[model samples]
Target: MHPLGTVLRSRYKIIHPLGSGGFGETYLAEDLDIPTTPKPKCVVKHLKPQNQNEVLLKIAKGLFNREAEILYRLDKIHNQVPELFAHFEENGEFYLVQEFIDGHDLSKEIIAGQPWGEAEVKKLLRDVLEVLVVIHQQSIIHRDIKPHNIMRRRQDGKIVLIDFGAVKEIKCLETNTQGQVTSSILIGTNGYMPNEQANGKPKLSSDVYAVGMLGIQALTGIPPQNLPEDPVTGEIIWRDQTNVSDRFAEVLTNMVRSHFSQRYQTAAEALQALTQSPPTPKSDRWRSLSNRKVIATGGAVLLGSIMSLYVVSRYFAKSPTPPNPQAVTPQPPIVTPKPPSTIKKFSQLPCDSDQQLSSPPPATGKPTWETDVYKYYGQINQKTKEANGRGLMAFKQNNFQYYGDFKKNKRSGCGRLSYPAKSNIDYYLGQFENDEPQGLGYLKLRNGNEYRGKFAKNKCQGEGVYIYADKTERDGIWREDKLEGSDNFSCKGSSASSMPTISFLSPKPF
Candidate 1:
């Protein structure tokens, strides 16, 4: 190991030893050549060949230079990868100086026996997989991927992969008299390595297995080696130890499958599966409405309050797929009802006949018009024939679907608006004016963020409470959707009334 304060190439002043691996030792150093108030610090990796044979050294040098060139390209392409400042051969020793990430390793956050929540684990998977996507796109495979090798950057809280196995892999290189190169040693942790990887054949999916093991360790609160394995199938038996959704569990399982071919072929494939939204179940559609209503009411009335709404008999004609109360398209028709329909079905609606309502509404929109993406059913003005009272708008396209009060076809009363498919916002349940959210309401986002308090012209204004996915709560005043000040605010009138929007008095049959 280089002694403390030792200077290399008359430039890098070695500060201290970082760690030692099978092939090399790392040191923290200061670059004196770089002109800065405080000299920039960098990580120096010293790789020493096991043998001094002239033929072996020549082969190793070639391999080392080739790997360094690719790493340089990777650094320029992705900020997450450390930038390769310089590489040199000093007295038969190979040294690599690179950008030093100012953050602790993931092992600190992923403490053994201290499990992380599903949301946090999911975020970690995305952060790591995104970087892997860029790395793999360049036809490079990260042979070694573990918690200790992944750094959680303090500046922006991004994940940075470190300690590429090029140096370590070179240790296994050997050349025969025929001048052919061969490798025998595997380059990965045993617990995280799959069968193929352990056989000295690491694939892109090998890195995916390591990341999957990291997630399992966080979820189960157990080290990868300590986790039980299925002896018969040779797969890790970890599902019983964690409380994760079945869909998410399946993704993780597929990533860590024992067979490399059975797993996702690339990081991009794995990331897509992780973030893709699962199809909503058929039974949970109306139950979600009742549940949201119960939550909005703070469990004061439960399902009984929603049960009081008058149900139109037309909804009973067909059992449709369950719908998530989120918007479908960028534009919707509720804000401005269409002109008098030539279909003549508007006059056929049973608006005056009232009846007791039961069960929940289906996901499909009524009338099934080929051009119309949404259909509104409720009170209509006798003279103008426009939506004039409480109504339920079902959407078939990607746009906001409103369930609330209306005046002259404009959303101007207490109601809930479902977000579109691509929007980060989930559902906004509160008061509306001129077809936009206004006044108090509860807004839920797809990323597990929630805002409750006040809104004006579709922006978060006035005092509100912002709850982050990590369970951090911020009570503050916001302007134009940005938090400006911290203050106490009450969200009392945000809840919608128990009165249903779709009353039996006005029903538009398909």
Candidate 2:
């Protein structure tokens, strides 16, 4: 255990031990560099290889550094992720400094005997799914995503994901007859991990499976380990254990399907499904029809038929049976055409916005076209249209809004576009030409990823600085949104002057 009051790098003073796991120990600490009334507290994690063998230790060290890099990048892009402050080796162990979150882990809230209501479970699903979307987009999987790893922030009640300690490549060394070593490692939690993950071939959907298990646990009040599964199909049999809306039940069932193909492919897809309205059941539709309307229609039809029959009979009696050579002509029964079924169209989710393009009026300053465009577009507006001066056009829908300068009715000069509602990207403050992003500007995505540099026709092009979510910056030339010939600039939080210079020493034999 790290000594209490012990200081690292002459800055972070260890307060006390927080927790320990198979690979490392964590501690609460205070940053002495800042001269605030009360020094800010932070978390310090010590990463030590479980195996002391030289070959295994070397591999573990490499994995540890890589994990640090992942955490650093992810923190920059996601608010829910913990920030990495510093990472360095002390003695034989690697230590990481990170922002401290004062809150209780979700395990405390999800008690074993207490079940969460539909509303509570739904809220939890949204909160966690949003974070997963960012994580998956970065190509990083949180192999371990249980209640213990999730914390509810006391300040804002936001769910914060902690512990990237499990984000490492496992190495299992094997010796052949010729004395050559080969290695592989499988990583995941038993109850939450899917078959693919357990087989060491985890995909993005593996994380989705874990989240589904979490939802099930919340609803059933039973821990994942205690829950039962089908022996042949391997699907979780959870519906019988809890009472939830059929829509939510269907969603959870799809999410935790035995086959990854049957599950929601991505976090965004899962989120859309969660927020979507469920299809009305046939029985429920009949219930929705008004009883009075059905009775009134039936009564009207019956009375009309009786009246027609009486009138026909009276006419027949008055005219008498006319025996004629012509046989009674049989008329075709009245046929009523059923009204065409109206297909219900569901509203598109925010994630679907990427497929849609907003088309404003052209450079023509005609009032009629402008008004018509506004009416057709619904949310578009000609905020300011001067004869020859720079004009401003605005488009807004819900939380997304765009204000740009227009020349000859086309987007020109600088513009600001905000899309807080989008799941993929956020706002773009940059140059525009012909209503498209062109020249230089800054683009900030919702996942905390940002690019500052040249853009052409709305794609990242030419020289630019791409800052990843983990706070790593890459400076290079980009083509069609792809970074090319790029090199790492600098770690965001660490500085040359403040960071300690280190020289590796020969490893002591185990």
Candidate 3:
């Protein structure tokens, strides 16, 4: 209808865009002014009407305003959820600006699929229980604990719960949401929702049930529906579920029990059981940003969120370029017990001295994301001429090197980063102020792709360009790390997806 890239309510300058679900659009924006801010990019999710019905938009707008009222109260107590940014009505459209997560959704991870071995499910549930404890302590019910609403921040691989506090999330996780329309139309998804929630009563145990089901899903690659379920009883069908332990199954059984009384009555109880002194599998992914404090401020407006988010210092925005993991193509269904590989370390690199420049990665076959599974585990110095002129911070887990940057313990710089190996590719090197990749730097990827530019907080925010291995080049402004501004005539085609040349205000909570 309106031009494609229309700027909403004034303050939010959309960098590029994230996905748009039943909720409204999400953007990665920069706060106009604020240095050393957490979540420099913000996600704008304008409230969407529940139904396509005409009058519903009007009612939805009213309910949308109530969200801010709710947040303001919660903010007073340091709620970890998103802060209410600018909420406004312009041209009959209502909008909201909030925090942005630089990570993948738990649902996407589940759908894409991974195995949950040993105490993996227990650990995941325990992490959730802790969040719920905080939420319950705050007197809030995150009725929607489904995968889609739960995000895994790539920074430290921690789960950052989003989209709670809404009547919709409340309705979905706790009450009979789908195929039922009493006070509210069915708000939750099918399958994972508990039976009580499906019938109408939304309670704490209902969340426990869904979370239990999430455990089964995590352990088994199948979705809840695909898992066995009693047709008459509507109970989870767990008989033929292989690789699941009796004790673990018992844990889920008590959790997802049909009746609320049969389920874990409270988050504390659930947390207590899950927290049994069991040794966490070293390879299981548990890194997270939950511990990081996020300080939000509009001169006293953004105080609800913690002062920082847990994340290794590095840029996180990825190019929209489709993932081509064909190099690591393996047999379908990656189940089966495979001992995870260890992250390679620069400390383990040959010639750990300062005289000779560390050698560059062999320039023959381009290294696939798989070839460098342990790449993130080590400090990669592309500057092989002498001592550490430039390098990336990497860790190891799940057979790859997770990467980023490390100077002290702060995520102080930027580069092409990846999850698990949890590493980053340093494209530029130089001075840093406020953590943005300020000063001069050069990034040379193992794939022969490279970029040398002036960075701001890691993004090519000021001005920069890249010369690809195939000879293509891009020039523009970067928001988080993706390009946002217009590219030159020739660069437009190849640089179409990643908005690296973007510009916006830095992220400020609230």
Candidate 4:
């Protein structure tokens, strides 16, 4: 390994070795100068060139790609993930630049014999849940959530999750609506792995289960790897800890349960309980969301159906049955009906305070619209004889629409947007990356309120516009779904800033 200082990416002056793993070695690097404020430092994870197994190499490359994807998704939301600095390949090798945290991975503490303190466990997990709030909101799942990936800083005593090398993202089933691909990274350290991941049903709750396992180990002074196991009976040796608090033991037991349905579901639910005065994590909502059984379509459409593997596939694989358009026989009416001067097919609907629009008309055609693959609006013809090179999956659900990809059979690819799409409704149609909106898209509201702008995983990230159907509108730069600045609105005004925001409400449908 390179000694104290080895320059990398030309700009990063390597300071010293931070850590090393089976895959690669990490280095502390300092940016030369940018003339900003304090000196900038980052981390460089460089793959080891010595490993020669081709199959393993392919797996490593896949993991590297997964890591990059995980970091990209994390950067889009409010998680504790480190920012990506750069990713490049050179000299038959690959490298990734990332934010360097001045902390130790919790693995270090675990190895050094971390004491089982209930408060300490709660504090660490509380922060992790806060981070999960943002992560789950974006539909991004860090399949490999373990102590080693969590960087606990010494300076501020805060946690910054690092090493996404083992992460697996949850694609919002759409482009490949079939759950064809389940990631094989198989993250987590043995005992910490939930049955879903081990038995292959992992989702957002998989990470929650892992975290809960970590908490159990921390609270009871039992190392997960070495936790007692009744081999003959196939039971965990946590009865003593259960004696401490039936509630805590019950939570831990479920967390490590072999069946996904038996484990904790959402981080939100567990966090809510863990953060409570006595740690009473709820199971209902978490279970509901977990049992959703999200799958990947070659399209990004989410057909929210929960069932066993056989049933789910049978339901999803059911081909579109073309309706007989010629079933209606013409009937003669005794009296001739005169057509009205104008056809008023749609009626007005309620709108927001300063908005106006019509609700979508009663159902006609199919209750659900399935596009072969959604491309840019007006870009891909829904009814195209020619299967263009491009492929995406999309479908409508109730008043909203959501999408993602076909990961072999698991949700993969990218861009799964779930936004309302009513006739005159103003809803968010966000451009997605790895399922959640990540680029530019649009939002339409029920009152004919429309906003089109840049989005970073569903939230407004850059310049956007809010327009009304009656010729009123507002356009401006957005930070987190909210607009920034003052400009000309019909009667209302906006606050202006460097980005120069503008906005106006509209009136139409009504």
Error of 2 at 38 (Å): 1.8
Query: Which tens-of-lDDT digit does each residue in 270-311 have in candidate 4?
Result: 777665556334564344434442323311344333435555
Angstrom error at residue 400, model 4: 67
Candidate 1 lDDT: 0.72
Give the root-mean-square deviation of each candidate in angstroms. Answer: 24.6, 23.0, 23.1, 24.9
Query: Which of candidates 2 and 3 is the stronger one according to TM-score?
Result: 2
Cα deviation at 147, candidate 3, in Å, is 2.6
- Model 4 alpha-carbon miss at residue 198, Å: 4.1
Give the range of the ten consecutive residues with the poorest summed lDDT in model 4: 346-355
Candidate 3 lDDT tens digits, 473-498: 66555544456654332221233223
**Residue 249 displacement (Å), model 3:** 2.4
Q: For each predicted model, how many residue pairs clash, with residues at least 3 apart or on different chains?
A: 9, 6, 66, 57
Give lDDT tens digits, candidate 2, residues 229-345: 899888888899988988899999998998999999878788989998878676555444445446645765788977766766886888788634234332334589964321111
TM-score list, all predictions: 0.58, 0.53, 0.50, 0.46
> What are the per-residue Cα lDDT tens digits for candidate 1 across 365-454?
443222255676677666676677667776655555666767676776556767566666667676566676666666777778677666
**Could you tell me the lDDT of residue 354 within candidate 1?**
12
